[model samples]
Target: MSKRGNRLRNQGKRGSRRAAAARDGNDNGSGKRGARSGERSRIGRFVRRVIVLGVAVVLLAAIFLAFAVGFAARSIPSYYQLQASAVGQTILVRARDGSEIVELGPSFGEWLDYEEIPDTMVDAMVAVEDRRFRSHFGIDFWRTGGAILEGMTGSRERVGGTSTITQQLARNLFLSSNRTFDRKAREAVLAMALEWRFSKEQILELYLNKVYFGGGAYGIDSASRKFFSHPATDLSVAEAAIIAGLVKAPSRYSPTADVQAAVDRAQVVLRLMREQGYITAREANVDVDTVELKQQSGQNSVRYFTDWALPQLDILLPETSAPIEVWTTLDVGMQRAASAAIESNTPANAQGALVSLDRDGAVLALVGGTDYVETNFNRATAAMRQPGSSWKLFVYLAALEAGYTPDDRVVDTPVTIDGWSPRNSSGRNVGETNLRTAFAYSINTVAAQLGNEVGFGTVASMARRFGVSSPISTFPSMVLGSSEVRLIEMTEAFAAVSAGGMAVEPYGILKVETAAGENLYRHEAARETQLVPDYVAAGITDLLQAAVQTGTGRAANIGRPVAGKTGTTSSNKDGWFVGFSSGITTGVWMGRDDAAAVPGLQGGRAPAQAFAAYMRYAVKDRPVEEFDTDLDLPEWRLEPDDEALFGDPDEYYYIDEDGNLIEPGRRDPMDDSFDVEGERPGGREGNRNGSGEPPPAVSEDFLERATGGPVRAPDPPAVPPRQRPRETLDVPPAPSANRQRDGGSGQDQLIY
Candidate 1:
């Protein structure tokens, strides 16, 4: 191609080559211009792309901020609920004398306004908890940035020191103390919400009022009272510092647990306050010895009483968020006496419960157990125990209501009802005697016969009428107090008797008042309804008086007129004594919680002694008053008759060395003449005389007639004396001369 120009007619085109050079110059210039234009176009396209990317990034950031705000708003609670959380109120239970028994629910001190809080307290709180609390809206961006930086660089597992005062308040009011990402997000949102709805001062007030202090105290007010025995208005600078320090670790810095540790923590708070200009340097130097602490009273025995009465408030008043003051019917004095008596008299291996009621059915004193601290099970109001022979009160009451008086004649021989044979405690029949005598002697056979005479259903009904709310089956054993019942119910039943047939529902609470002194509940006067006819009650009272005056209940005597019943369960598992005197009724019970038998346990022993001891203090101030025995009924004076009167009228009853009833002409078994046939006596034929016709064989229907039920067959061969079970009558005592006149030697001794 070079040659093309070479040969191009070398010589011939000298003029043509000059023209081509001009054209080439023009084309080259145009090409350079085009290249420059393409470069400028590429630069413009890159600028446009960069502008679009910037716009998209800004939009994404705005969307993220919107989503975060919406999520936080959704987790916020209503304003009313937030305010309600601040009024955590507790109930204060007071005795009849207005002395504090116990406080139920979380310990809460009196409510106070923001202005009521001491300035030093507020300043110390702000200095130690959050120095920049006043400046931040809800979150501290500066602190948050520091926390994030530290978390990334430091060895800490998680970010911390990010929560401001507002944030802490939000957590206390609405959020849990869970260190989770979601929780932190919610807490931040709630803090912002609080800041929006409440002012700075209002937020501070809520925080101070809702925060927890150590030792079961809540709020600054409670802390003040619990630590200093004064109101929040009287908070000293040192005290304020000590309380403020507790917000970090309450139990570790509790003034009650360790005063030195609390004071050391408070020193840190004081230094922080000084650094923040909240206090002067001189003011920050608080003397540790000046921090006088007043701890709450140690756990009290009266806690048992309050625990029992706490549930009753729900029935007595409407639910409320305000504080309550419960005025109970408990007599502080009686309660102490009852506690002492039970503690002194209760066996070491056994527990005791006591209940005392006024004629109006007001519970004056109740001891659920010997030591409430060991166990809090309320035996008086909750334990279900077999009432034992005390149940005979209902059986005899049914009989008396069935037109049978105390003077009604009854036999005290071994009796069987529905295959259940019961013998006198003495293991020997007293033969024939009036109902009064039989009851005073605690004759189990007479009680069984009386229960059969008045249907078991009737006996149960009588018990229910007397205030035994426990379920009572119609089984014949119920007549002997086999049913389980609460001690409160039994005592209430006796209170009804003391009230002259008026039905009684025992009550412990008298009134409930609000912290503002408004009446939330006031017990209305109980309506008096007839549970039993007055005559029947009087007749029952007669039997009870006779029992206490000269019978098994003699141990319960308080040197005054008293009426009561004694009950000893089988195997000595339970012993009970319930009595009334000076218009006050009380019941005492002793037993093991496992129902384990206590050797030598009897109603006439420990139970009776406790009842007497308590009653002595209970009625010490009341005037001595006798029971109204004027029922205008027929006289029941005893007189020697031709049947089996072998001694003086007053000496017809006989008792052996063990204070158990013995048959006439049965002298001391150790005497040589005790078994002499026909020895100066008018004994029945074949009855220890060994001289007349043998006793007739028992008829097939005899057991059925005696038990008020059908008998499958005649009695089996007589059981050997040693093989048959003996129910020795657990009687207290009687005069010894009565037995001496019959045949026993003159020696008074009581079998435990």
Candidate 2:
């Protein structure tokens, strides 16, 4: 307008036209912009309305789902009713006299209330299981969302597990153990219901009562008692942590099944507790070292009997909900005595087991080891060890059954069978000895010869008859106890002999009864078939009696008539003594569990000593009954003929310094001066009196001439030294103190 205004009035009309045209263009542009803004506003309104409708539909769907879940929850069974209908009770095992031996429960054990559980146990459970248990209302939404996200992301370490403690309780109580969305939805609903119905403490109580702690223990009360021998209230922090750790996998982490695994899992729980401020690191460390797990009842010496009887329960009472009482054939007094004897007589580095049975095959006493707390291995009935010379009992029995008399002569010299030569433990061969003497001494050579004569197969058959169930090798060494056998079987074998050759099956359970005094089952004593003839058994018993009286098993004699055999394995790895009285039969074995040899240990030592010590108490207050030796047996003549012995010059006679004759094979007394010198009918050159005539009593004149000293003759021999029957004594030595017979190297000596 400024440029056009200069054009003056003449251009006024043209300037006005140009200004109008510019104004029109501006108006058109403004109108188009306003139309576009209005259209955009309408489109925005439509989009907002669609979004509001979608939100309303989603809210309606959510309301419907919540209502559906609530309605479904009403169909769920009541937790209280479920528990009330559950079947869980304890079965008690009693001794023969009605004393409680042990108690076994259902697959799970008794329940405990929340107040009865220790705070440490609850803290451990919360720390290791669900840290938000106290604050969460059945379900943890934050964890659930995170778990869903992690699951969708395929994260390896973050697998979905959004269940809280209440949820787990719901699942365990009402839901099946199937990993499904439907099950999880129900679990969540039930968990919510449970949380609404019970307080936090009540929920924890229900969870503890329903959880499983392995070894057939369920609930905190039973788990605590089973693992710590105490109530849940008495559990220490370490033990509580151990129990809490078993929730994931009970049997895998059971303290009794795998202590190290339990301990490791407990360590993790302790760490979690420390992290959660439930316990301090120092407290956890101390408890870790001090925790003591309960020894399983099966670890007791009574386990040897109980294990044999537990299976009978299923057969007697197939399905029972009430408590049952099992009466066993166990003598508590004898069990204690046997345990004491084994512990006292066994070496510190060695282990010993003993098993005793009555003539009727009732297990009277059993000691699996010196201390069951140290090891749960039931050596009395579970371990197999070489019986050593004790095996000769069967071999000799086979021979006797084969018509060989106790007095039958057998060569005691070394012999070979199948390129296997057996040597006597004595290290010297008694040229010839009767079967009785050979068995008494446990001569390996004679036993081998007898086994060969009767055939190893026959020997094995005899062993089986006597209850030697372990496999027997058909080798010559088998006669010398080369085969392995258990103490229970060995004791049963002797019990069979005590039962007059009847086959005996060792048993402990006598009867089972309900708490109401209703007899569920009673064992009827069965008549056993005769495995060995009365005469054969009697002959073997005679030989074994001789063994206890005068041979290797002499240490086992308890002043009454006893029959037994001593066995010492090679390198002294195992020592055994199996014996029987008229009423009871007992077996004692000593060895290292690892098969390591114990120096100086022998069957005649600790094993025999243990047998004797145990037998003394086992037969207390019982009548001293004698074995039935009714068989007509040949007489045993052990004394050698003097003429036969003196006929050979090579058979040198043992003589003392005083010129007294001693038994040819008997050992000389340590205090006596003895020598083994070749002696002719006449005295030798070095003899003080060379003349083959008894020297006149020493006189003072003769002593002075011979010694060139004024020494009076030594006081006349207290008792004149007896001269040899066929030889004259040249000089009589000074009299010595009274001497007793010394059964020395030829006799079996106590090893340790």
Candidate 3:
């Protein structure tokens, strides 16, 4: 009883203390603190009170976080709302004559919403990238474990990412690309927030549109257009499977990279469709034997065209606003033609490219090389091949400007500049020849000589004035195309020649029209200076044209008038042909990827053949429009000290070897003068001259004779000149076992 009383007393003391504390609380501003029961009171009451307060706060926070995540998830964007659009890049066509090349690709999307993405496309991606997509909320814990385990093992591979579609959506949308724990934590929070805020369908749509599919493609829409040339809305089963397969590794599965790999990946997706019940096991068509799959060729090989088109995009859309598809002027048929011809004609070990453009510098079709897949080195745009004799045009243009007639003789013998001797490809020097034969036969020696007479600086300036971005230093050998030039520059320079020497900047886009049909931009060429005199350019065109009829460029002739030059560098390391017709101009090149010498890949051979094949198909239905005439030069041909049309052709003396009017061995300048017509060896057109002198030109008295009389000199061609076919040498000198032409990176050139 005493013990019980003590307990009671202590309890009473505790109660008193508690009551005092309650009174203190009342005094401090809480109405009153509840007192504990006097003796043996239960602890449940106090514990319960604390529990209730914690629960209430947690419930409120849950409600608030739920609201926040929902709002944030709903705010996900379909596309980056960049304040401005990036400018497009430029590409040149490799067609022979026409610039408006037809190209086929899916039309641009008007406005693609993620929700409209086909379910198949989504599932295909899940099958290859993350099969557990729908089952996970925002993160795949299993995949995360795998990633960690793999990372710890030292391989540190990126193959597995645990983040679910929700997490990816959050990261891609609201986060940055830094791979750090802080970023991962933020990503997780965003994922959870997104899951709470949006429905799976909504999250899925955002994911589909946000994921990058590689190869410069962004959303599914872009991937669809670039790879298959079709929109996601119209995708077929095979195409959908292919796209889904690409999600694993777009670059790896890109048809452009490996068609077989892409096809195999698609098959894997088809098998997944069977397992997922998206298709019946038998109906899934996973059995290669049963299903006939139409392979979608990636042919993103618009390499050369893309290069040309990319630049015009910025000009048309401007960096300020690129909100539309800049429809290019490429001709699908011609582009296909150019690409196919190059691929088929290029030697197995050699790479090649071709481009065709209109007189206005509008690209028609382009192929960078035989295979952009094996190597991304775009031969058409990025590869600088020694232009060989094709570089003579600049030298010839300079000669024309410096008052050197094409008929004037230039020694075709050996020439040395600063200890660097230039030799003809044929190796056998064809003694004294005229400019026509030198150009037609691609005589390197004469070009070097003329380059010296005209001054190498003059040739370099002429090339630059025409907008050939290629660098050409003032070197004597530059006349032989020792300087490097890209196929596009070569073709564009020729286009300038075709356009009456008017400088024209090439473009891919005509206008950037919005979905709403608002014209954002329209592109018209910005003109540079006229590089050559009309008559001079026209005369050069006429001279090179004969190359097709009876010269080294004849392989390019395909029943129509054509003018072009053949270029084969030392050791045949680079071969090129640049030609133009009435409304179009094209450049072609062939070489080995390693820049090694390839057998029989000269510009006049394979490249010219490819051009012919493309043009044969490209110009079938078009009218036969001849090249433009030179209004600058007088209409009728007159010997204004001209060597071919006048008597004794009041010779505009060229400094021959010994600096004498006539070598002691020859009486007349005719013996050494360049033959205006090359076939006769030191003789008149139909008469034999034993004195080793070409017969005098049309007599001035014959000019005074009759208009109907064929007294002496031949009359100049009448109608606006038609491009004559070009011919190639039957047997070009084989590549030497030693030495290659001086070529550098895409833009640089070094010839020593």
Candidate 4:
């Protein structure tokens, strides 16, 4: 203020002198006008200079404040260093069987220290991300100027960036996402502070380990692990470069999420490496397609199974990075077979489940749903649906336990119970038939009647023992297999019988290991004895074998000795087939995601075909022998009928000493001698129980009148028959009926 006052006084004196001079020159009008104009111009120029100085001072203070805030933010701890007390972003670790599956970073992005990363990995990363990184403190001003200059004349994206890894990490970790001048200044300030606080190695390490590489992978370790199923240090040149280039935009360079973009970005990185003299041009320009990533890396399709196995994993292994080896029983062959069987054979509109288990509860192959890629729906253990006639297997077991025999007859007539009248799917009568025929045909009427006779409580108790979670009803409908059951339950129950009647729970995930290869835990199959007499299971098995050979499961017959039963919900809504050849037990289920009906669908059609297809590989090179007929079985024969036991009754006088009509209370007359087939088990020597398809169908249908070539190669057999308890076809299932059914549409097994 004092200086301004002195200047003003001087200016006033000068102006007065000028005024006196102007008065003398009053006669000269031009001179007076010139003096006035000059004084006005000087005053305006002084004010403009004052404004310019004030604006410059304000901008300097703002820049300082921006730098100060960025410096403070740079003090936060990194992802690897953060503790519960640390004021840093969250980092959640996920492990399976004590081995890290993946680690998720906080919204701020993930970070790791230099010591935690491999030097090779760091080198590879630098070579691809920022070849000039070491020469620059945090950012490369010269390169950035070039980038900006190039971008001014070209598209921004096409021009790319020259930010060193450290600067990029600073921008990602401690600054705004904005790109305006103010934001750039803040980013620059943070970059400088990061350089001042951390060594160059430290900065680059954080950049390499914190950046996302898409496919939900965070950090170079995770990105490498996610894309190649290998550790960062193990990365090949191409693989390392591919991950390195992901820093620009993870989604664009993700091998799984965007393969084309990833390849393109990888090429750019290779070119940059050559231009920057990191590698020879010829070395850098290798074909990326020739690179082989770790198998099953980006396609972690086993997520569902891995998730379900986690809870059990905790009890077996409560922590990560242990030294105990846990071997899983998963057979990759079986897993792939199950997946392929479902994907290739299931009707387009339908979703399905496939589970393969050993007699001792070991899960050989398990596919929870049609597409793990589309949805992680674990149909094997999570989904529940009515077992349909498949539930009859348990009913039959209960009947056998209650002293019923294969020859025992049950009525096929409609019956009512608790306001429900259960009828056969076709609503037709097949007259009196033996249990073998009844089960083979999947007769709903007979099954319901038998369920009533066995006592609903007895059937329910048996099913529960076999590992069913849903409640079973005490009604006639229970016989027709109307209770909701999971694929695991059916698989376990059927596996029990195959295992001589012992329950085997399906399980996956052998063990998980740390980055250093330290084993944490392993899985053990849980076995529980669920059946009393092994013979009872074998009896059911004998009948089931016939089903695949000649009954509804004919499609399931791969010209080999296969034992399985087919089940179809009314109207082709659900189809199921559970089969076993000695040790391998596979269960298949097909149903629409929206629960739509498929035309001509039966358990034997697509489900059986799929089972057979998978079985071919699931048991490849394995023994193909069945349980010997003489193993721990009871000495029993087909029971005689009422006509033989009661000497033929003449009226509805209800004579057999029981109130029941179709079922008799008096046991049928026993056959003093065993039936020829049951007595001489060695007769099966002629059966096709070996390792391949039976001699191409010598049946009249498959062969032409002369040439044995299939009379029109059978359409790759669809799964499960078009229906359970299929009607005695007015005509055989041929190509003509097949095309018509596809056009007609329904849950009846149309391929579409």
Candidate 5:
């Protein structure tokens, strides 16, 4: 082949090979490009499917959130509706002359509007409870987020709560305080609703008006009045802070519960107020010492009287919601006197009670315990204790009604009946004595012999007739006051004797009326029924006068013609003195609530002293009048011979050379050994030297000489003193016997 031909052929073959190579390279390149494009398409499709799925999930979440928010919003209540509900009213108890004594019912004190509340109080509440109250719409998202972050971080310090003032108001007014998520969601929704319905000031005003402060105070005004004795508008910055801080826990921060805790909480509130720019640091600096917190009044002062009178309200105005005024017969002066008497007389660990009544049975004064705030036990009317020697009044009255005279002869020697032996309080029995001498000396043996002769049933009936409502046992011990009786009932019975034998029922509430002055009930003076003959009552009065003048009740004398009896029970568990003046009958009792024996306590000591102290004030302005006595009885007949009655006349009575009694149980002023300023053996007014101590034995001749007459022999065999069948008599003693003695035996003997 020619070179050109060979070159062309080679070139053709080479060009064909190159073209084939190019074609192969193009095929390979196109295949590689197609494979890359297929992979890119697959990746783009996957990305597109993922983006669509994410968008769908977001849309579903948005729809669910909208549904939940809508449900929560629907649960909100109308704020205006809640404001229209009725609130409870306070009940007022007033003195007889219209002075306010105490308040009853659910909420105490009056309610006030928002304008009446101080601005400091509002600022304090906002700063301490919700710092972002003004900026938030019921709930603060920023605060909520911070709290959530804090919880997630496990921070120790409490993260600020997210509830705004409006939120708190909503919860307080319309929602339950449940801590469930559902309740929280409802609270948030209700807060928003409240914000939408009311302005910021209106919402705050509602919150202040409805928030509970401690001490039964429901609103700011009530709380201010209860704690400071003033209106809410008059609250100082410190006071406002103190009250505002109570919202967290009223009882826990109550000043009455712990003043220091309340003060500490106030300090926190003040610090917050300063931090929030509500107050300056200087203004926030409060001296807790200068805070004059008002002491609790009404409830603490007259709890006993009010407790007793409260039960009567149900009967006065039963099932009624209206406020009422109860008029009580309590005399503030006498009540103060009684309270002072008990406080000054009783030991710190001991309890005492006093009840004073007018002749008509009007309860003038009543002291149940030392401090009513410490305890509400009404010891005066509720406590039932043995009367001890005070019970002898009935026994003597029964004997007198059984035709026994005060001059009748009775043996003071030990006597036995039904396996029971009775001895004189002196331990040594007086051989023979007249009834008057035995009665004056409080001889147990003589009293027992007389009680046996008259019968226990007779004494029990006499006590009932004299106004003793408690059960009276038909036992010989009843004559010695073994039966229990209430102080009030005993006082009433004594008042009956003072009222010339007329039965008197003690009453405190004089009238009950509505707040509008319409009378619900008015006390009418009940006609007194004669419980005993006037002569009989006068006789007992005479005897009791002698008792005070020379016997166990000498300590209770008020420098007037007073009649009373001293009673000291077994183990000194109870010490009592029930006395009566012309106008008042008062009973004083000192003892332990647990019935534990009070050391060194005797009826003639503290009890009689307290009685004298109280009566001196109780009868201050009243005219002193002498107790009525039976005119038929001889004036000096009841006076026993001191030498005959008490073994040593010098020990019991001071007699002049003329043989006339000078001072009973005391040294005569004329005696050279008598030191006027020196402490006497029986120092108290009503107490005698041997008042509660064992008596000394007297010779039989001394007894005859003391009686001012010869001792008559025992009645003949026609009626054996012990064998004579006793008859029960319900009448009190005759005036002759009652007026002749004021007698009670020693600690060892039970004599009245």
Candidate 6:
């Protein structure tokens, strides 16, 4: 205010102002101190909370570790128990002559002490699998942390594998292969248990002796013998490296699966070994070419037979864990021949299976697939494909039993039953012919008529009596071979015919015994009861022989008294040839697994060719046998009698170029133009003479007369192979609305 009221009065004013200024400065300093004090208090509270949280997290982790350890301790088995069950008893399967067929089940070669395992192998496994195996007690904390981090960030190459040898050993010995949280926890706990219970060398020994090495080899000893045909003691560095490399993925890196891949994997293992200072650089530089695998027969197909026979052994010796020897009925030579036939004749993108049975129903040979390594499905006994016209065996047998002869007259004209129409492969149906002619020709209409007349129940009974184990459909289409059946059963049925009407159960194992030579089970040869009358068998054999001589099955003729049938399904989905020659009944099937059509496949082509090829070799050593059953036979006729059927001289039949009987002089342009060798025109020349060409096409006018309406043959719809819905699907699959394309039958006639 008043500028200090002048100098004199200013003395008093100045004194007051200085006092106020000093008080103000003191107040400002106190406020700053209060703010600093509050900040220190807040920091102290934050520090205390952080300390409590850290303690809580540590406590929870401790609790979890303790619980995991307790659970693992309770579940872990004794080391001795693990060793005993690690590899089951080895199953030694021998052929009929007592020659070794294969060693199946858990095949452990020989147990070796920890010192016996090669140090190079131990080092390679440890270096590639775990870097700090000796330093880590059980879990490598550094790698585990990295694995966790990678998993959380979704960057782990694969999540949840403990990158340590001990963990892998724990999994191999006592854990399932599921990658769940519980499994991971148990794996970690068991890993720690293993590390604590056994020394590193002991753990390594167990790992080497328990790990799978593919090709059914378990343990290092077994793997060495399987891959190198040598004992583990003799495994070279390269061989050891290859065997050790299989620890990661036995199937993917099997020497038999891909030798180059195995060598490459072994090279990686060697480099890891050298990097970890387990071997010198020179020792790790072995040439891949030097790693020669044991020479094995190209026919690994025997594995299929062994795989099939192994299960049967259990039936003979139930629940017994002792090592047993299974003497099978397998003829090694015939098995090889069957494998060669299948490998040579199976079409690309298609699979083939064959089953051969001796007169006593002993399985002579079985070819499950063209390449057993590619697929071990055992289609001969497992695949349920439609038997096509091959199913007519049951229908014809039923007819023969019902007082009908192969020479009896049958009609093949276009006919419908209960809204189902089955067309012949050649589209045109011969009007009237004997059962033998229809049988030889594989006429669908005639077979369907016989199945209906004999009653579907009776036909099914005949199939059952012949050892057809699968469900038989009673649908109208079933008469046309719509029911699915196993190839083995079909072969067994044919074997029954070959055995002169005895019921036969297809058997592979002749005897079972302990490895110590104690008899466990021996097949007692009993006289088989007759399932079909002698006349019926004789009639079926006559029909079958005629079929091979001059019918769809002409390609299967082996120059002897061979009796067989050719079968093809709609859309060419399946091709089958089942026959008997020289007391051996063999059935062959060719088809795609997905039931997709193969454009040109036919039963008379590849299937019959394969049959003929195998049979020629199969019967070469055996005496030529005739199918004379000492039963009365009827006269065999090839052509239908139009004069007897219609009493019309104008409708006299004339033989066309492709083996069809046409009216008078009507001819197709496609006739006489077949490019097959040994073909003769103007008569039954193509399929009838084994030319493998389909019958001549039917005219549109003939189709109109057959169906009472103009018919167009459209592409057949794809029908999935049927499986039994309940225990069995006796109801037939819905027949296609349009005419079915010729199954593999070679004839162009629609089947269903």
RMSD of each: 18.4, 22.4, 18.6, 21.5, 22.0, 17.2
lDDT of 2 by residue, 1-752 (tens): 67666778758878899999999999999999999999999999999998999999999977875675567567655657756644356678888787877776654455667777788999999888788888887788888887888889987563124688889888877778899999988788788777776789878887887777776676888888887887777888888888899988887788877888888888888888888899987977854646777765534567656765677677767687677788888988888888889889999789999888888888888888877656768899899999888888888888777656676555567667766788787699877567788888888877777677667888888888777778889766788888898888888888888877888888888887788998888888887699877887888888989899989998998879999999999999999999998589999999999999999889999999999998988887788988766575322211122222133322455444455565645544452222234243344333335643232323446446665768532222333221112222122211210112113233222110
Candidate 2 overall Cα lDDT vs. reference?
Answer: 0.76
Model 2, residue 79: distance off in Å is 4.0
Q: Name model 4 segments beyond 4 Å from true.
A: 1-208, 211-216, 220-311, 321-326, 509-530, 626-752
What is the Å distance of residue 208 in model 3 from its true position? 6.9
Q: lDDT tens string, model 6, 559-660? A: 888999998999999999999988899999999999999878888899999999999988889999988644553212111222222223234564444457
lDDT of each: 0.77, 0.76, 0.67, 0.65, 0.74, 0.79
Residue 265, candidate 3: C-alpha displacement in angstroms: 8.7
Worst 10 residues of 4 by lDDT: 731-740
| Model 2: lowest-lDDT 10 consecutive positions | 733-742
Q: TM-score for model 6?
A: 0.64
TM-score of model 4 (CA atoms): 0.51
lDDT (Cα, tens digit) per residue for candidate 3, span 1-752: 69999999999999999999998877766322324333224577677878998999999987886775676656744334421222222222322333433332222232456567777787766765667877776778888888778778976545434667777667666677688999887787688776666677766766676566666565677778777666788766677777777766778988767778888878877887778777676656744333233354545566556655666554455364323445567777777888888888888788888878887877777788676556666777778778888888888887666554555555566656666677666678877666777778887766766666556777888889877787777755677887787888888888888787788666666665554566667666685677677777876777668777678899989787888888888788888788876568888898887789887678788878888888888778777766543435442233322332332334333323344453233456354343556335546343344443454433445434534434443333332221211222222222221111211332221111
- In candidate 4, position 727 carries an lDDT of 18
Candidate 1's TM-score reads 0.56
- lDDT per residue as tens, model 5, 1-752: 78899889888998899999999999999999999999999999999999999999999976875565566556554556655533455678777666887787656345456676678989988888888888887788887888888889998565235677777777777677788899887787777766666778888878887777777777788888878888888989999988998988888898877899999989988988998899998998878657889986534446687777768767766577677778898887778888888989986589999999988888888888888866678999898888888778887777665545555555566566555676555689766566666666667766676677666777788988888889889766667788889998888888988988888888888888787888888888998598876656776777777778888778898888898888888888999888899679999999998989999888888999999999999888889898777534332223233222233444455445445565546654544331223333445322233343323233346546765556543323322121111223333222111212223331111131
Looking at candidate 2, what is the lDDT of residue 90?
A: 66
Which is the leading candidate under lDDT?
A: 6
Put down candidate 1 lDDT per residue, 1-752, tens digits, no spaces: 58877876785587688789989999999999999999999999999888888888878866764566555556556655664665345788999889987776667787678889899999988888777888887888888887788878885633124688889988877777899999987788778767777789988888887788876687899999988999888998999999998988888798877778898889888988898898899998879668778844535557667877778887878878687899999998999999999999998799999999988888899998987746779899899999998988888878776556676556566655667787667779877677888878788877877677666788888888888888897777787889999988889888888888788888888899998899988888787799877767888888999999899999999899999999999999999999899999999999999999999889989999999999999999999987775554321212212111122323354443344564554455442221123242344334332544221123335435654667452222232110111122222211110111111233222221
Instruction: Tell me the deviation in Å of residue 708 in model 6.
Output: 28
Ranking by lDDT: 6, 1, 2, 5, 3, 4
